[model samples]
Target: MRAVVLETAGPAPHLRDAVLPDPQPAPDEALLRVTACGFSHHDALIMEGTLRRGVTLPRVPGHEVTGVVCGVGDGVPASLIGTEAVVVPGDIGHRRDGGFAEMLTAPVASLVPLPQGMAATGGALLASPIGVALRALEACGVAGGETLVVTGASGGVGAHAAQAAHAMGASVIGITGSPEKAQRLEGKPWLDAVLLDDEPWEEVVAALTGDMGADVALDTTGTSLGRLAAAMRHGGRIALVGQTSPDAAPFAPAEAIFRELTLVGSLGVERRHVERALSLVAGGQVTPLVHEELPLSVESVTRAYRAVKRREVLGRVVLRPVGF
Candidate 1:
């Protein structure tokens, strides 16, 4: 098995490509011939040495994995062989080796079979940003005909959240720090408006909604809790979905008190959420969220790290193993 290892973590993290023995499945696990893996900010953080908890050096750090089940261990059904699936990275990428190689093993319970004809590249991200997006919307309790604001709307999770909310009949407003990204999210059939983050975007939202503010706020950037609260109408709910930074978010307790605002923190996803994400794709409810795909190599991984750090990536960055 050929793999890329994070040999060291620093301003310039060292990456080494090595050939390792193929992983064997445990009693409750399935051996996966990995096809595609989403390179998430979580993976980038681990490689950049910013996030250290549950991570060690020289690790294989890819969690959003899509692969084919080549074999299954005891307690697993043999009929599952040759099934294309997406693995929910439970403790795999963080606590142990993950899907950064040609082959990996995932617990059978974490595997979600792909719908009939879903491509491996697109299926790779169903568990993370897509499933995570749906979970956030459920946490916020967004309903049809409501005004929903999505911060960092060009991002992986935020982009999907905006589309899914739009599909659910909500009027969507998107916020992006990058002008280029703003253009990409603007004028979309799924998005009603796009706001640049150069100014206090909460004010823009207030103006756009005739001073009533948005009915729901989805905050993908963890640092903008206070701003999101300010952009919401009374009794509006805010779902904090993604954390780009480790710092404590600035929030106004007064808004939650006098304004009767609801704040909810959401992370990870359940099997039902993944199933919903797949359904959305299969039904064409959401337009294709094209990812920036690169082949697996030290150079490509480093390139991806820089793009994510600069917040330039529009959607998820996917990495494909050699031989596709």
Candidate 2:
């Protein structure tokens, strides 16, 4: 097996590909032939040593994974062999070896059967962030005829949240930092409107919602919470999922009390959320946007990490491990 190993963490971390023996499955695990593995911004944070709580050294740091069942241990279904599956990202990429290798082992219970006709790299992303989006939407309780606002709507999680919220019948408004993203989201069927992040979002939301304000807001950019709250109607809900911005959002305690706002912190996804997210993909209700696809190699991996770290890409970036 070939794997990218992050042996040390620093301001300038280097990931090198190493040759190793194939991984064997545990009694309750299955061995998968890696197909596609995608990168996340969190992967950059882990490599940079900023988010180092659960991350261990000499690790393969990818969680968005999809592969074919090549082998399974005792008590696991033999029929799973040759089946395409997605591994829901969790402690695997954080604590143990992950999908950067040619083959990896995962608990059979953690594997989700990949739906037919879905792209492998897209399946990899649906295994992780899309599920997080579903959980955020559930936290905010978006419903039909309501207005939902999403910050950082051009990024992976926010993009998926926008699609899911719209598919569920809510009117969506996306907030982006660039005019290009705003124009892009404005043309999408999922978003009813698009606003620049620098704009007066509260006033825009009021006008867009006929002075009632948005019923729910998913704050994908953590620093926009105060403005998001201001754009919400009284008793509205805010689902927070990211902490990308350095500064905290300024919101008065009196504002929450007077508006009777419900603020919810969505951490990660559960198994059920993964299933629902994939179903959306299978049904064509949501598209997992991949900004770039690189062959799995030492050089490509380095470039992928750089792109993710710099936030140069619009959506998810993935790696093809099988052919490469």
Candidate 3:
């Protein structure tokens, strides 16, 4: 089968054609023909050798995968054949070869049936970034009518979280670095306000809530964007989901203690959150903002990774492994 193989980990991965033995599904597994896969910054981190511990070499890195079940192993239900599904990217890309290929073999338990209206591109993203957003909100205990702030709101996870919070009746405030991105959310019903990341965050906060500040803040910037941390109201909850800036300084302990804040760390979307995200997409309660779709050829995969590393694209980048 044709797959993007990572023979060595470095600043970049080698995208090439290599012949491999056909995978034999285990008794509880299903063989899937991959249709689409979502590319994330974490994939780049894995390639660059700077991620969580215990990452092994020569591994397939994609986790956000969507495809159709073609074959099932013993002990797997026969009913899943011909069904569209997405494989959950489990445990931070561990113990599994990912979806960036012509075919994938994953446990049947990890498969989620794709809803009728969910597109392949959207399906692939739902299991990862969207799941993270939903889990973040749940962790922070956000509720309707409460104000929530989303830093890096233009990114994949941020956009989905903003919409989910909005759907839950929270007043959503999105923070972005570009006016063009701020303009993209103009007609979005979920957003109560949008602010530029470069502006004075305090002033923006005062204007949004008459100086009360946000009830919850989800930071995806990975950096200690002081404004986001400062805009939280007393007793506000914060969920840290990403580290765009790995070397960022810690948030002020004194400030957090004085405000009686709840700061929680979130990573990897669990099975339950992935199910909720899929259901939301299936019901059309939320739509993923897919920015680009590239062919699954070797060259295309390399180009897509470069674009992601350079931060040249907005929203999600999907790879079409099978022509539609």
Instruction: Give one digit per residue, the lDDT tens place, for model 2 in 214-322.
Output: 8999988787887887788889999998877557788777767878999999987878898998889988898998888888876777787787656566778888875
TM-score for each model: 0.96, 0.95, 0.93
Candidate 3, residues 1-324, lDDT tens digits: the string is: 777776677765555555566667889999988888988877777767667466665666688898899889999988899888888776425446777778889889888888776789988888878998999889899999999999888888888999899888999888887787788767778778888877886578767887877889998886644566678789999988887755975567776777788899887787899899977877778888788988876676677778767666567889887552
TM-score of 3: 0.93
Model 2, runs deviating above 4 Å: none
lDDT string, candidate 1, 58-109, tens digits: 7888888899999899999999999999987777677777777888999899
Question: In terms of lDDT, which candidate is stronger, 1 or 2?
Answer: 1
> 15 in model 2: Cα distance from truth in Å?
1.1
Q: Give the root-mean-square deviation of each candidate in angstroms.
A: 1.5, 1.5, 1.9
> Number of backbone collisions per candidate, in order?
0, 0, 2
lDDT order, best first, reads: 1, 2, 3
| Full-model lDDT for every candidate | 0.86, 0.85, 0.80
Question: Which regions in candidate 1 have their CA more than 4 angstroms from the true location?
Answer: 247-249
